[model samples]
Target: MLIVRIPAEGIEDFRAYEDAVLPLLPEFNGRLERRLRNPDGTIEMHIISFASDADFENYRNDPRRITQVRLLEKSSAKLELLSMANVP
Candidate 1:
C-alpha cells in the first residue's frame, strides 16, 4: 500500500503523477485494488498487489514508471510504502 500526504497546492501534481504511471501496472502484473482519500482530500491511500516479488521489483524499476515519477518530485507530497500480509 502507498500512503500519500500532499500539500494543498501539490495535489494536482500528485494526481498527475498517478495518472501517468498507474496505467503501466498491468505490464508488470500489478493490480490496483483500491484508492481511498480522506474527506479533507489531503491524504490518499492506494492498495496495490503484484503477482510476485520479482514483478513488484520490475514495476518499481520500469523505465516508464521512473520517468513519470519525476512528476512526484515536482510535488510537495510525502509518500510511504508499506508491505502488507494477509493473515487468517
Candidate 2:
C-alpha cells in the first residue's frame, strides 16, 4: 500500500503524476486495488497488489516508474510505501 499526504496546493500536480504512472502497473503484473481520498481532501491512499514479490520489485525498479516517482516526490509533502498481505 502507498499512503500519500499532500498539501491542498499540490493536488493538481499529484493527479498528473498519478495519471502518468498508473498505466505502467500492468506491465509489472501489478494492479491498483483501491484509492481513497479523505473527505477533508488532505490525504490520499492507494492500495496496490502484485502477483509476487518479483513483480513488485520489477515495478519498483522500472525506469518509467522511477520517473513517475520523481514527479510524485516533487508534488507531495509526504509519501509512504508499505507491504501488506491478506490473511487466510
Candidate 3:
C-alpha cells in the first residue's frame, strides 16, 4: 500500500501522473486495489498489490514510473509515500 499526500492545488498534475503510470501496473503483475481521496481533496492514497516483492521492485524501477515521479516532483504539490503490508 502507498499513501500520498498532495497539495490540493496540484491534484490535476497528480491525476496526470496517475493516468501515465496506471497502465504500466499490469505489466508488472500488479494491481491498483483502491484509490482514496480525502473529502477536502488535500490527500490521496493508493493501495496496490503485487504478486511478489520482485514484481513490486520492477514496478518501482520502471522507466515510465520514474518519469512520472520526476514530473510530480516538478509540480507544486508535495508528496509522501508509505509502504504497508497486510496483517493477518
Query: After TM-score superposition, what is the CA distance of residue 60 in candidate 3 from its true location, in Å?
Result: 1.2
Off by over 4 Å in 1: none
Q: Which 10-residue window of candidate 2 scores lowest in summed lDDT? A: 68-77
Write model 1 residue lDDT over 1-88, tens digit each, in one string: 9999998888888889999889989999999999999987789999999999999999989998899787898888899999997889
Per-model CA lDDT versus the true structure: 0.91, 0.85, 0.81
Model 2: per-residue Cα lDDT over 3-63, one tens digit each: 8898888777788888988888899898999999998656989999999999989988988
> Largest TM-score belongs to which candidate?
1
Decide which is better by lDDT, 1 or 2: 1
lDDT, candidate 3, 8-87, per-residue tens:
77777877887899889999999999989898766777888889889989998998799898657755666566678888
TM-score of each prediction: 0.94, 0.86, 0.82
Q: Which ten residues in a row have the lowest lDDT in candidate 3?
A: 70-79
Judged by lDDT, which candidate is best? 1
Off by over 4 Å in 3: 76-78
Evaluation by lDDT, superior candidate among 1 and 3? 1
Question: Which pairs clash in model 1?
Answer: none
